[model samples]
Target: MMDCQRCGQRNVLEIDHVLPDGTEVKFFFCHTCEEKWWDRDGVQIDLTEVLDIVRRHRE
Candidate 1:
């Protein structure tokens, strides 16, 4: 189990999103602090804004 970096909690959950190119992006959500981040080639990216846009444009 991965620990949440924001809250130091051990309840970090992994979320996978498949892209149009058949690639997958892995994100982590912290259940304790509600922190959201994505993994891009081993680098962590803040996904709060991106996620908001996606949800807003979805059907």
Candidate 2:
């Protein structure tokens, strides 16, 4: 189970977000603090990083 980064709550929600450039990314949302981030290779990445990757996508 994933815990919220801000509130350290174990009640996390999974969401599918499409970036401005049309890249599909899966991230987790912390219901406690409303913290959102992507879990990649055991690391939490902010939404801005995901947007950057999406902007670089072709086709």
Candidate 3:
């Protein structure tokens, strides 16, 4: 469980996800602050980049 950066909550929910290109990532949600973020290879990633990656692989 990771801490929520916004609210400093100690129990952020984490979900593992795979992109359209089969890239693995982790999605985190903070219940307290209603914040969401994605991580790939321990690095933070933006939702727009994730969407672009999916769009590029759709063809």
**Cα lDDT tens digits for candidate 3, 1-59:** 79998989977999999998999999999988899999999999999989999999986
lDDT for model 2: 0.74
TM-score of each: 0.62, 0.66, 0.93
List the candidate 1 regions with Cα displacement exceeding 4 Å.
48-59
> Model 1 over residues 1-59: C-alpha lDDT tens digits?
77787889988999777644444577898988998788755666557645654666574
Give the TM-score comparing model 2 with the true structure, all chains together: 0.66
Ranked candidates, highest lDDT first: 3, 2, 1
* Regions more than 4 Å wrong, model 2: 15-25
**Candidate 2 local lDDT, residue 29:** 81
Give the clash total for candidate 1: 0
Higher-TM-score candidate among 2 and 3?
A: 3
Error of 1 at 56 (Å): 17
TM-score for predicted model 3 compared with the true structure: 0.93
